[model samples]
Target chain A: MKRRTFLKLATATTMSTLAAPYVHAQEKKFAGITLRFGGWGGLYDETIQKYVAAPLEERTGLKVQITAGTQSADLVKLVANKENPPFDVYQADSAYMVEALKADLIQEVTEAEVPNIKRILPGFREYGEYGVPYSVFTYIPIYNSELVEQPLTTYTDLTRPDLEGRVALPAATFDTWSLYLLALAEENGGSISNMEPAYSLLEQAKSNILALAQSTVAMIQMFETKEASAGVISDARGHELRTKGHPIVSVYPPQGIYGATSYMNVVKNAKHPEAAFAFLDQMLSDEGMLGLPRALRLGVTTDVKLPDEIAKDLTFNTPERIALKKKVDWQKWMADRSARIERINKILRG
Target chain B: MRYDFTDYVLIVAGAVTRVAVYALLALPAALVVVLSFTSGETMDFPPAGFSMQWYQKAFESEPFMSALWTSTYVAVIVAIAALVIGFAAAFAINRFDFPGKGLLQALAFSPLIVPAVVLGIGLLYLFAWMNLIQTMFPLFAGHLVLAIPYVVRTVLASLTLHNRVLEEAAMNLRASPLRVVRRITLPLILPGLLSAAIFAFVTSFGNVTVSVFLTYGGNVTLPVQLFTYLDHSYNPLVAAVSSIMIFVTLAVILTIERLIGAETLS
Candidate 1:
């Protein structure tokens, strides 16, 4: 036999051998079927394809087709075709999941449907009925260590006069602004019910904020150029920027971190329920749990042993960290969102 | 020209403003092209060093290549489809005086007035109601709707500029109506049709907002892919991919120019 053919055979054999135990009866039943997914795009899509899709496909003979789009866009598509959704499974972040549930765009998932739900931590179980919280990310204040003389402990610190003209914040139109706003509200003696205090603090911080970034990429660009020495960003993003050689440290406030959870949901009237369940279950599996966090530096929903280096960076699923995660009542947050947005826009834009 | 201090300050300020505005518009694109050649892992503006590894990585990746192919073919199809429909409509509007000529013209140009996000959502619902959601039909149809207006406008302008004397002369002879149209009308308007085709291609190719709504099972265009990529992560790969996208668009334009002659572009 040719050397290339021999190597190919050996590689295939090793892979199949490794993927043996994951090949369950359900996966066998769903063989040759294609399961469509609407997902968070970019590297996340690659991560899913590499870890979740490949293994699931190998085990089940099922193909996973991930349609790359934002969570809000996915919901719009679902509402447009509520009776017949475009995908079997889709992703939604914390804010939009409420809208998805209220609109009945996604159906409920039982423990039996996704057995891995038991592995999920109690703190992340707020919306377990509608979807599975596969990953947990948080909004924390990240500051450039070289530029910041004193580290940021809370959102209030971002408005300090010393950091004036060196701090960047998300623009009103950016979706992630809501997540940061919740952290400000909780830390500034306000709740989801009342956001006046948060707006008052933001009014004061106007002088300090150098730029209102139009997007996440713009925020990161601000940091790279030292135009933004301090800002409120997600722990995942902070970790990513750190990896990319930015001299920033993510600070977990004494109060708590604001959770920005990502949920995986089976759409209402999904074309392939069995395959969808199997995919969701695999995501919560030991290997599956590692797949997501490894890619984005996010904390896993399930209690899977992570490598020492990664475990140190993650700020979720642990007892102390979970307690530190302050979640907003998304239902209350969404109500009068436009009015609230206009109010903040005035404060920030001023 | 001897200038006073005030005049000198104004001249300097004017030059400075021009340079700043130019840089503001051009720098982001320039930085992407530069970063695509970076040896570093991240998207550093000045670029840590220089390399072609990212370009190599871009070609190897399946998702980007697949998206590129999808964008190219969709844009090409949309451009051709727009041209055919546009020619017919423009010809009718130019030659005849219909009852609702003004209204029809307004309707043709209305997509430009409506925001893309609204149009995208409206089309999504419309396509869904028609039971044409999952197929690639929505994507193609949505892009076609967006591209048609530019096509109609361009073709109309071209039709208006043509010498009617040529077509009349053809008719004055024993030539048929079809013969006059084919020989005189089409040949005179080739450049306009080319311009309209290019406009349609650009409108369809660079679309993101509507494409986001119309994406079928893993069938996404290049611009939407880039937009979605930027949403979740930041890296040199994005810069490299963007550079590749620029190259692809330029190649399409150049290829068309080559086939139709440089005068078509002019």
Candidate 2:
């Protein structure tokens, strides 16, 4: 009907098609750059490699090399290689993030560099610029519903006479042990600084505990073997146990659930800053935030809503649940961790 | 054939003790092998069902495969190096009376007494100071230190047990010292050398504490990988990996026994 309009629309379509690849090519500008990332091993590393690293490399043409280690070991490497950092991007738990920030091992990020940062839940974004929140999990009481008769509402329930010789406590060396201690302190009318009440209560509950588990895996084993009926464990692990048909359920206590967050930071003297930023930005994206939950049953830090099935297991997704997460002064707690651990150990022994 | 009450009791007690010892040694390994074949996702005793899916998963995992290769490569190198150095040291200590020989002997076995964690940290610091912490050199060096002690101990025991008469006779017959050692001393100790080599290989292959500190970049050993994996999850995949390791180690020992004879190990 109109020859001029037809030619104009065809040309516009052609121009837009040509411009699309150009824009895509511009996004893949970090080609030839190799980004070295340091993080935890096992399922976490595998998940990130599959869902985050591989996809990021395919989209951006940037190669990613992952190095996995324990939290302390990774921190040691970062500190050792400070002048010329070994990792372009490093993953750290919330507690170690404070140490990394204090030592100036990692750098700050703005929304300009990581646009998806804005999508993170408001509560989990308190690390400021030093670290980006990747996942959130709560250390709460997990019990074998078959063995436990009364509903477990709080940490104090662990001391109940019925749970005698059936409760498992995390060892002093584990990170969650600190969270458990903090929760116990809050429940027993002692703050993080003054954990005397917590120690006394734990001492009183000592006769009830079966063992001080070396790790969350050990705690899970205890539950599986029926060696212990109840123990403090991460919500993710509880979900894993439940999924495995282990009759385990995680209870968010009335006092408050101790929340722990894992974070990713860009090393200060990064070899390839742009590539690191790009990888980090991808980590915070809708796709990136979904990987943790999908791969490891971990709680996502993003405000991105998950399917109802997964959301039901996660502890701190909703506004109300997030409000129930107890906030600890990690800096102060980490400072007194050794003394607190020693005190707790003494109580357990006695 | 008639026995008193005390003699019969002793016989029964001895039989029970032997059975208990065997069970203690064999049950855990059997349990691991059994669990590796479980169809269920979790690691449980009296496994839910029998399937080889975990073995396939173990083989397909990139990290596990890489770690297996790294451990094998390092263990092979460590075994060779430890054997050479240990043979020479054992020969020297056994043949000659040198100054500070006792000190050298003590130093060689020092690794056995020092906690692995201590040695690991010390090695980490030493490697960092030398600017070699990022490379696989630390891992190689640390494992060599650990492996050397077993080699030295086994070789020394062999040297002590065997008579030096043949070696002396070879030396007296105008054969050079090197020739004497090659012709007489070496053959006499070949069995011990083989045993020591196996010990060194196994020790290096299964090391965890030192390797944990020395592992850098992507150079983790299998044991370190397994340990790290256990921290994250307790699936039958670990059992599968352990079973593979046991099978490989058993195959190696069997192959060596066939080539060298089981009497040599004894």
Candidate 3:
């Protein structure tokens, strides 16, 4: 090459390298745009703001307005204002997603809009093309390590003589009772279509039930106080009790664990679609995916590497682990919810 | 010196009942406050260690502080509005006969009988269809509906107990009705008003159901915030937030006591 040509190329390259930051600033075209997000509060919201929203704001000059609200109420807000959504993105759990879809309250986006959609575990994308799971919770059997002599392998084991009058389970009134019912059903050769087997199994287990706790807090307290020798609870909650110096042990049942998930979806009539999609891409990114796992021991949906200690305390931490995690058929469950709740109430409350 | 056996038994039972009532009323709250200082992750009873980290987090948290502020201002506004409207309605009902007086009385106390769930959804759908939920009016109105009944009841009771002769004397001396009300009636009902304000304040502040349906993103009251938090999961921070809430209530009571004598509050 001629010296003149080499000099020209070097000078131009240096100038462009110097102007790269300026070019990046220009690419931040969404500077004035604000994306509204409806999400969980407490540690969950705090973690999202810290890990996903803040960095995205700095990188793209777009602001995220995160509004904390009850999940069901939030869906009501969207349904009430279906023509003009108040939020651009929202965190929708299973029941909310079903109802939102029925009401046509959310938009569907493909991998073209959000590249990270490809990274979301296929099982966690059970909400179809509308949303992807950001974090997952597991329903696992637990027992008082110091009180119970035998290890529990299945929900059927709660009927064992050792667990009689020392077992506690969630009442039908509890929001997440379907998962527990499904576990019992799956273990007894029935599924969501026929939860009848689980009820009869529950009848045998009834003699053992010290109480059907009305809430998760009640369930935890029963375990904490050793009032319950063996039962089922959220994996994170069990691990939390263990972390807090309780004698609780999480048991892996033979059929595996039940999956309860929280998802991030774009609102149907979002004012800022590109910005909302960008925010979603970051949520599925490695940094954002690990926030819940780090904060609350929730399993990450994407294949983000977690510290071994954190992974050990969580469920669905890998594709293999997720493969074992069964997502509930929320539609069928929701449809039969009233009848099931009534029957379970009679069985458990009795 | 010479007490009857029946008298002694009655006295012993009375003493026992008083202690039992105090233990039932106060011990649970005291234990919760004690658990709030827990250094451990869970807010279990009889905490293992002590730490102010939760309180520190509560004060530092933007969402918590914002929600606290929202609850405070919302309660303050609702209480003030309920106080004015309640005092007027109670005075009018107490002072004069009107058409549909019985119906008006029933209407004032109607909210107490109607379930809060019904009211919440009623108000939510009422203003929600108009898209007025973007403003704070829906929450304010809902709280007002829930709070007005308490105020009206308290003020009506106060007005009934008020001496009518003083107002008559003031009027006979050529004092205007407004002046008589300002001078004689209000001073007499001061205690009732004070107590009623506290009722309204606490009612709006601690409300969850109606507020839950009405609250938007930034306007959530403290109770709804805590409710949603617990709905998702429970953490020690809840205890801390609750402790702060108790402290705020106590502080408000103390401030009122200082401003108006405790006897008046009682």
Best by DockQ: 1
Q: Cα RMSD (Å) between model 1 and the true structure?
A: 6.6
Q: Per-residue alpha-carbon lDDT of model 2 for B1-266, expressed as tens digits? A: 88999999999999999999999999999999999999989898789999999999999999999999999899989999999999998878887899999998998899999999889878887888788887899999999999998999999999999998888888778999889878888888988998998899999999888888888778778898888888778899999999988887787789889987898677
- DockQ of candidate 1 compared with the true complex: 0.73
What are the C-alpha RMSDs, in order, of all predicted structures? Answer: 6.6, 2.8, 2.7
Docking class of 2: medium
Task: For residues A1-350, write the lDDT of model 3, one tens digit per residue.
Answer: 99999999999999999999889877686799988888666677788898898888888888888777777778877777777777889787776678878988788978999999899776678877887678878777888868987777776777787677998877775456547788888888999999888999887677888987777788887877778888878888888788778888777764777757788888888899889889889989998887778888888887777899898787665556666777677888778878888997788667
* Model 3 CA lDDT for position B236: 79
- Backbone N/Cα/C clashes per model: 0, 0, 1
Residue-wise C-alpha lDDT for candidate 1, range A186-297, written one tens digit per residue: 7778877777777887888778888878888888888888888999777888888888788989888878877667888898899999889999998889888898778888
The residue-by-residue lDDT of candidate 3 on B1-266, one tens digit each, is: 88999999999999999999999998877887898899988776679699999899889978888999999998899999999999998988898998988898899999999999788878877887887876789999999999999999999999998789999999999999899989999998888997888889999999988887788656678887787677556777888899888888788778888988998768
Q: List runs of model 2 lying over 4 Å from the truth.
A: A1-25, B1-11
TM-score between candidate 2 and the true structure: 0.94
Please report how far candidate 1 places residue A62 from its true position, in Å: 1.6
User: What is the per-residue lDDT of model 1 for residues B66-112, given as tens digits with 9 covering 90 to 100?
Assistant: 88899989999999999999899889899999899999888888999
Q: Estimate each model's TM-score.
A: 0.91, 0.94, 0.93
Provide fnat values for all models in the order shown: 0.88, 0.48, 0.32
What are the lDDT figures for the candidates, one per model? Answer: 0.85, 0.85, 0.83
Query: DockQ score of candidate 3?
Result: 0.50
